[model samples]
Target: MGRVVTLGEIMLRLSTDSGVRIAQADNFCAHYGGGEANVAISLANFGHDVYFASKIPDGLGEGVVKHLNRYGVHTNFLLKGGSRLGTYYVEAGIGERAANVIYDRAGSSFAEMTESEWQKEELFNNVDIFHISGITPALSSSWKKTTISLIEAAKEAGCKISFDINYRGKLWSQKEAGETISEILPLVDYCSAGKLDALYLLGIPEATEQENELVYYYQEIRKKFPAISVLYSTKRTVVSASCNELIGTLWMDDHYYESQNHVINPIVDRVGAGDAFSGGVLHGILAQKSPQEMIDFATAASALKHTIHGDCNQFSEPEVNSFLLAGSGKINR
Candidate 1:
């Protein structure tokens, strides 16, 4: 696979221990993650040449690169400037309770990055694909301009654009998200987002019938952006904080491919699992896998992520394939 470029922020994550509340924890476990950074690490872990482009606080640059380097993501495109790195806190919840996230991203270097500070064409060197998340543009108007310019540069370079509509209601309003995401949809060759995102980002109303949502979402995207070559999403049934049922769906060439649902027990962390799915699907695309293979590989990778602790998907490519071949530990008639 050719080199892929991913642009977005990487934040400092301070997470509370299992079954703990954010306000009660005296100490926290530190990790770094963000939508685009997680995607870059996922592709890199799958043995693809991935370039992670972004800005961090001046002194924090080295630490950020170190984390990406540990995962094989190339950090040559990184720039530094802001006063502090963006940060988020996670409270890992238990059964019947959902995990909680608190964001502290304002005035961060990535959010403060100007269009002139980034040399898009130069950063895009050797890039075959460009990936981004909706979270990037929601940061600030300046970041929005930077994202727009970056997408335009990628399009000019004939690189495929991959977008994850990772809607964060805490960061921006639905109206703003819809407007911003709609602007970039025309340039996207591949898109990944779930039901709520479709509803908010594209103004698609929720289907009263649950089974119809994914297909409808796919149809609406094609209706809105005929240029999109592929659309995919993951369906998850969270039985509890410690367990989830995972499946992946893909739409391409007017056809749909759905993977078998894999049940995960004792989930370690759900943080970066979606990004893992994004990486796996993109990996399958780069490997020229069929639609069925793509969704299967992706869902299996996501299921495996639930068994690992931390923000990164620690499973190797071969490990993911092994799990895929294992048949989701259940047979459907």
Candidate 2:
């Protein structure tokens, strides 16, 4: 297994029960999650040597460390400092009612962390893959610089960089995200972005009506950022708040590969499915799987994630493979 590193915030997630609106909830189920942290957990479940790097409030951070350890993610690089860990709220949806997320993460420990706080030299030691997302840079001006530096340092340490353009409109504007992400793309090896990101963030022009829109955008992206060896995204059709049709796509070796559609009904939770997909793809890459295999595995992992209640994909690699072989809703016995 490869040694992987993921850097970002690990937040406390307080979510309401299904059909309970945030305002009406007197009780909530608390879980711990964040974009990069979620990815770390997934990679760990896949049997990779994964380390998560970030800071959290000293006392309150114990639970966070235990959570990561429970999932097999190493917390050696996790620093304990700052005033508070980040927290967010989720209102679970039912049927056609969509879920909602409220970010109360401003001034959190990870956001306030400085470059000097990290043990940079030791952090990247023998790391094979480094994963991060756009969300870290969106936190603060200081974080933006730190994110870029971390990427550069990882690259110098011979780690393949996997970047997910996990854009959050709540955190930063399109113009700002666009500018920041553009700066980071040239350093990225594997990228996760969709049509909207291509058009809005990367500033790729709209494809002609006759052209395959997503392919055109990806081609344009490759032309502009040649360092990106792999580009991937998902096509999701929302049937309702509880049902979705998802397809994973990959662009590699000058070819576009797609996974079969997965029709997910009665989704238990959808918050971390994308991160799960990203983790699957990274795992596939590390395992040297073919493009088609990678996408298939990734899509299946994502589908399984929708059945779980928390923001982390709890399924292991063998479980994901079993799901692929048996398909959904079949009795194992």
Candidate 3:
């Protein structure tokens, strides 16, 4: 199995049920998730030797580690006793409404933690692929410094690095996001962007042709920072809180490849689909799949994630391949 390492924050996600607002909800379901943690869980479920490193707050950190362990994610790099587990309230939205989050992550242990020699050692010794996201730096300036240091160390160690520009407007400003991410993109091997993320994060000018739209930006991206080996973007049409359509594309070796359209109706939860996509492509790469296979499997895995609740895509490879092979999601009786 390939070894994958992810470092960032893990938080207690308290989500309202029945489409109720956080204020109106009398009860909520709890789960452990964050950008890096969610991606780690997805890789673990795919049978990778995955380690997730992050500092947890004092009281609830151990439980979160145990939870990650249950999913086959190694938690040896997880540190405890910072301040408190970060938390967010999720209010699921429906038709004509939008989802919203209220982050309470300031001063959380992981947010306050910085890069250490031990973390650099973990990257050199255990990582074939190292993954992190924009959410890590959004927490605090210390985290931004930590992420940059870790990226440099990972590059020096010859580990493939994946960076997801998961811009959280709730956590930081657009100008800050643009500036910080531009500095780090040179170290990223695989970069993921949403519809306009490239436009805002790296200042790529908008394009006129909506179909070949992203390819236009690709030229701009290469002109500015030519080191990134691959770029990915997933197009989504949100029909409702529980239903959507997704199309993923990849640009590498000077060509663009797009995946088949995936329609997700009545999605169980949409939180971790993108992370699942990241996990799938990383898994494909580690397994030596061709780029076409990688994007196909990654997009399919993401489509399947909409059927599962919580922030982790907890399905095995064969289960995902079943859908990819023949659109088969039937009971395996």
Question: Model 3: runs farther than 4 Å from truth?
Answer: 114-119, 209-211, 328-333
- Per-model C-alpha lDDT, please? 0.86, 0.93, 0.84
Q: How many clashes does each candidate structure show, in the order listed?
A: 0, 0, 1
Residue lDDT tens for model 1, 1-333: 768999898999999999789989999998888888888888888889999888887776678889999999988888877798989999997788889999988888888776746677787776888999999888888878778888989999888999999888898999999999999999899999667877777887777766666888788778989989999998888899888888899998899889997888877889999999999889988888999988988888888777777787877888788776656554434
Prediction 2 TM-score vs. true:
0.98
Candidate 3 residue-wise lDDT, 207-322, digit = tens: 87666877887767867778888788788988877678899888878888889998887777888889999888888888888889889999999998888778888889998888
The number of the candidate with the highest TM-score is 2
Of the pair 1 and 2, which is ahead by TM-score? 2
lDDT of 2 by residue, 1-333 (tens): 899999999999999999788899999999999999999999999999999998989887999999999999999989888899899999988787889999998788888876747767798999999999999999988989999999999999999999999999999999999999999999999999899999999998988884567888889999999999999999999999999999999999999999999999989999999999999999999999999999999999999999999999999999999999998899887
Error of 1 at 118 (Å): 2.4
Checking candidate 1 for backbone clashes, the offending pairs are none
Clashing pairs in 3: 242-267
Q: Supply candidate 3's per-residue lDDT for 330.
A: 58
Off by over 4 Å in 1: 205-211, 327-333
Q: Could you tell me which residue pairs clash in candidate 2? A: none
